[model samples]
Target chain A: MENRTIKMTTPLTKEKIKDLNIGDIIELSGVIYTARDAAHNRIKENYENNRKQPIELEYQIIFYVGPTPAKPGKVIGSAAPTTSARMDKYVEMMLKQGITGMIGKGERADYVAELCREYGACYFLSIGGASAMIANQIKDVEVVAYEDLGTESIKRLKVEDLRLIVGIDSKGRTFQEEQVKKYKISK
Target chain B: MTRIMSTEDLIPVIAKLCMDACYHLSDNVIGALKAAYEKEESPYGRDTLKLLLDNAELASKEEMPVCHDTGMAVVMMEIGEQVSWVGKPLEEAVNDGVRKGYTEGYLRKSVYLDPLNRVNSGDNTPCVLHTEIVTGDKVKITVLPKGGGSENMGTFTNLVPADGVEGVKEFVLKSVLAAGGKACPPIVVGVGIGGTMDKTTLIAKKALLRPIGNRNPNQYYKELEEELLEEINKFGIGPLGMGGRVTALDVHIEYYPCHITSLPVAVNLQCHSVRQATIEL
Candidate 1:
């Protein structure tokens, strides 16, 4: 792994993401949108509706989190990432909408991993329980849409030094899947 | 005699207990993480361990809670055999403490009153309170804040005696693999074997309170713990399952004799931040 920071745009390319590996530590300095169960469903519904003017999503990263409400003087309260498996069902939908990367904890389902490989996307696992540590990296946050959803509402987060690992790379190689094989010892 | 504790007397103490436990990782847990950091072979796992230590430091300095899930208040009490009181009921006193702790400490209220409705408990109260009467004259209070991620993945199996230790090892590994990164890697696994179904579950949960990295008293159980740890790490679950050899920090097993036909086993997994505290009043 060379010490070169590649400045890539969203709708990430297969060639660019392919170079990433399981141990490659990188700072995600980009526009990552926030969404969880509710927001994922809403986006799916919009696609089904064939809504005339749909939100453009070609190279966006969706962060799986439901942050606590911001205290009066704070930007957010303990904004940690939730378990990623919960969003397995909605990955394909979001990926189709041009989601190139995902940041969350845990592993994706087999189908989700397959879709990620098919679509040239990647999955990055952040440090769980380090919400306050991660929260320090966010430069700003705003509710771009879905204010009614409260904590689950969709928001745009401007972040820096948001450390993450390539849990699943673009070449369809997943550390998570490999882990199962490595550890499942046959009696 | 039914001794009573007033809301004022109980709330502050409970609030302080919660805040203290949330902000600071206990010495035993920290020691385990330190040891895990040293022993972790994967670069990614080592990095994750660094981040964990950093998080703990930041939490202490910034006065921030360790994890977002400060967890539901679980009060384990051993009331004194002698003492009389007048004030609020025990439940009310505990609830008052929960309310103040959550509200004042700025901790998240992660509990839902009704499992079905999913309505917020508001204060994280109506705690999972359990009490026992003992021969002592003082009250012994133990606060164990069980996080949802690990709690969600806990499993219990009532095995047949024929299955033996091998069965216990398989169930624990399977549960850990199934959990993956959900419970937060570098986990502390608690195994309870030989008790009945519910008893085993309790044993597993209580086992978490033991100092991390410390082996069980029984020599057989201690060796089993080492074997299980080696097997779990081989999975390369690493830190947060990013790929490495440090899947679990330690495997702590607590066991008791069971019926001739029953080989009950339970697995209570815990994340890096194993938060717990106790007070003898």
Candidate 2:
């Protein structure tokens, strides 16, 4: 597929991502929230139990990450996307809570794709293991909630030109499925 | 006569190894990634490979971790049979080293205190240490910081003797395909054949320590490794499973004799950021 690079800003809405397709590269800017397994579980628990959430989720982007602690003079440490599949169970919950975009690495489950289509949400993939390079793109970070979770704390991050790929579009088409079909050698 | 060694002496060495392994991409992994970039057919795959290369360079230069998942410390120690330890217990020293390394180095503390409790250990402590008594007089220490993503993709199975080589190949391929982008493709595959079930899994993990492009000394296993590498890449999972020419950098197979009725096999995968460091003391 001939992929096109698009620049996007956070506080994304349905209109912003409705046209995004698999394989399109995105250079995203503005603010994003970081969460991983621990934070996700807590978020789900809070929502189900009618507890107050630490951060407002509506119209925001969530990046699945657990960054290293920054050294003496850095905005953040090696910050990169962790696997998204582990967060599959929480996808529908977050989307229902009004998160317009999710950024992570790897393929998601079939139900996640369906939920994205239903909720007009998009799943973006950052380069897995490209932590140092990704870290350079983050302009600022602050632990917004769950600080006791350590690396898994939910952090508010202001990023500049963070690179990402449209892994699964709002329409449920996935780059992984398309690429595998196109390239898998039938032997 | 046995040589007396102090457990305290290992603390600094192990600490440094942990930091060094996280910060620097091993030479072999870097070389393979460069080669993968050169040959990758997909634009997305090539771009991802380039980013990884740049990430490695920046990580080493800036003394930062290559990935956010600093990983659980898997320390393999080959202790000389003739050596006697003094000071604190060996495991205690190792844990201390891990604690100092993760805290001082600013790497992520990824280990949990208990499997069910789900609380962070806070120090990345109580690392998984595997020690073997060897004939040599010098102790060899190797630390492999195993990321949860690739480690989660590992699989083991016991096939009947009749299933043979083809079954092992099929199992490995299936595991890799199932892992897809999750394990972070362009991975290093480690296969262990024969031995008992537990031994097979252990050898499978140990097989990952072998340098990329290095083959097993045995002719048959070497050939199997070559064939597996070729086939896995053909799956077109590519650099980050976006599709391309290289899915796996190399395949290393380690085997041992097993009971006549058993054909046990295990597969372990290492992501592109293959972080391992070895030292002899």
Candidate 3:
């Protein structure tokens, strides 16, 4: 089957989100927020106490990553998704706050799968160990919030043609479960 | 007479190994990934392998890290009994090496001073070092810069003798399956069997020291390892666990005799990066 590549931007609306499906290969180019465990905790803590959210996240895409610090004369170090499951505890909260797209590697918890269905959100995965190659796709990266968290800081990434696969779709379809079924080596 | 070994000598050699491991993916690993790439049916899976191979090439050619997570330097040192080191202690020397390598190389600083306080170590130091003394004058050091994603998915259990090979197989499968997409398959699955609990797990980790595609010498275990690899890859976890034909590159098992009552089994996973380098002094 020929996989078609499409371009999309951040803060995707619900109608625009529905056009995407599980296993769709995308070359996303736009602004996305990067955050991981520590940053996720701080976001949750702040939201619970009714503090203003760190950034305007409504309908935004959050990438689960903690990039290595950049070397001199480098735009950013290898930037790739970390494990998404580690950030599962905060997904429901973020979805409630209008984060519609998540990116990382690995299968989400069963509850996370359920929440994606309820919230009409999607998940994307980047290739692990392909960071050096993937690093070439980014146009710019800046620490947008929580700079003290080091690599875990939320950053605004301007990406061009950043290739990815839709691991989970807004309709609750998933690549790890459904897509892998066809290729299973029969016992 | 003892041959004097100094932290002065150990630090530079170990530090060099750390940088080399980050810059280059061993040949065996590259070979295995290429082989898997050739046979993978999913275009997505194949593309992922291609990108990783590209990353390996770019990192090697440019002297950049293969991935951002240059990892915690898990250093294993073998000190010959005849060699006595002066200056800092062995652990401190290894940490010094890791610190210099990560800082000087401009790699990511990943260590935290305390779990509760969460202070970054600034320099990636205090590497996990293991030492064994044997009967020679030379020192051997191995650095496996272990990343967090894959390390988070390892499993260990003390299986009963009755549980047998079948039990071990099931455990290894479940561990890899649960690790799907997270450990970055086609991973090198390392199995440790027998010995006391602690000893068994260390040997399991040590099994990762072998290059990808190398099998245990024991015919029985080698056959078991092959069978396990064949089956796990069948689960369609593929590269990046997104779903595909190849999930594991190889399975390496190490075993030692244990007490009559216990059959301890430990499974440690190495991601596709398979970054490790060894130096002898």
Predictions in order: lDDT: 0.77, 0.92, 0.86
Tell how far residue A97 is off in model 2, in angstroms: 0.8
Q: Point out where model 3 deviates above 4 Å.
A: none
Instruction: Write the residue-wise lDDT of candidate 3 on B1-281 in tens digits.
Output: 68986787777777789889988988888888899989988988888888889889998987888988888889988888899778987788788888888877768888898989898888988888899998889888899999998888889998999999999999999999889888988888889999998998899899999877777898999899889988998898888876788898889999999999999999999898999999888
Model 1 chain B weakest 10-residue run by lDDT: B1-10
lDDT of 2 by residue, A1-187 (tens): 3889999988798999999998898999999999999999999999999998899999999999999999998989998999999999999899989999999999889998899899999999899999999999999999999899999999999999999889899998888888877777878
In terms of docking quality, model 3 is medium
- How accurate is chain B of model 2, given as a TM-score from 0 to 1? 0.99
Q: After superposition, how far is residue B99 of candidate 3 from its true place, in Å?
A: 0.5
Candidate 3 colliding pairs: B181-B241
Per-candidate iRMS values, in order, are: 3.0, 1.2, 1.5
Clashes, model 2: 0
Highest-lDDT candidate? 2
Cα lDDT of model 1 by residue, B1-281, tens digit: 55544435766787788778777888787887888789876556677788888888887777677777777778787878774545778778877887787788877777777887556666678778877888856787787777777788899888777887788888998999889878987889998887788789888987887887789988998999999998888877777776666788889999988888899999999888888778877
Clashing pairs in 1: A10-A59, A11-A59, A183-B235, B3-B85, B4-B85
Best candidate (score: TM-score): 2
Candidate order (DockQ): 2, 3, 1
